[model samples]
Target: MADFDIELDASGLNCPLPVLKARKELNGMKTGQKLRLIATDTGADKDIAAFAKMTSNPLLDFYIDGEKRYFLIEKGAN
Candidate 1:
């Protein structure tokens, strides 16, 4: 179990909620910090990836476990 600087559980949330929460969580993190987002929404795969690309954040990892989608995003330079 790797410890992330920010852990956001967006399971059961709808589209935008996961992305929104991820953004907010990342906003409070310092540069180089990591955010782990756990989401159950299927759309999160694309949504989160696009969010990271659009925001210029590094998408460290993206994978699926059972019904959950996990995203590891590293905070980008300010």
Candidate 2:
């Protein structure tokens, strides 16, 4: 399994915050670097997807295990 370059725990944070924090981290990452965000908000499914689309980053993978929503994102070229 590919390890993420950055791991962000957004669990317990609500909508927008997770996506926003992911964006902030993604903004500083180089192209091709991956970020893993773990969120507990049920709404993260939509928020993270839209954030990736809007930011032009690629949503590498998404999964739900127990109460956590795991999202992998690759930073897009500048």
Candidate 3:
């Protein structure tokens, strides 16, 4: 399986932008690849979760570090 290689920094972006950027980043990855998303938007916690569910992608992990929120998502089958 391919490992996570993409890093999307959405720290300054808001709700939709964070999710939208993540979606766009995921689109450029192959199946089994992973994406690392960094965002400061508080809403992204919920938005990213819902985005993963809606797209059927797997959210490998999520956590908050100080002021930053990080998400690791694995690309799903297309």
**Judged by lDDT, which candidate is best?**
2
Ranked candidates, highest lDDT first: 2, 1, 3
User: Which regions in candidate 3 have their CA more than 4 angstroms from the true location?
Assistant: 1-3
Per-residue lDDT of 22-59 in model 2, one digit per residue for the tens?
Answer: 98898899999999999999999988999899889989
User: What is candidate 3's lDDT per residue for 1-78, written digit by digit as tens?
Assistant: 235678889998987999999989888889988898999999999999999999988998999998799999999998
Measured with C-alpha atoms, the lDDT of residue 17 in candidate 1 is 98
lDDT of 1 at 67: 99
Runs off by more than 4 Å, candidate 1: 1-3
Per-candidate Cα lDDT values, in order, are 0.91, 0.91, 0.89
Error of 1 at 16 (Å): 0.8
Clashing pairs in 3: none
The alpha-carbon lDDT assigned to residue 68 of candidate 3 equals: 95
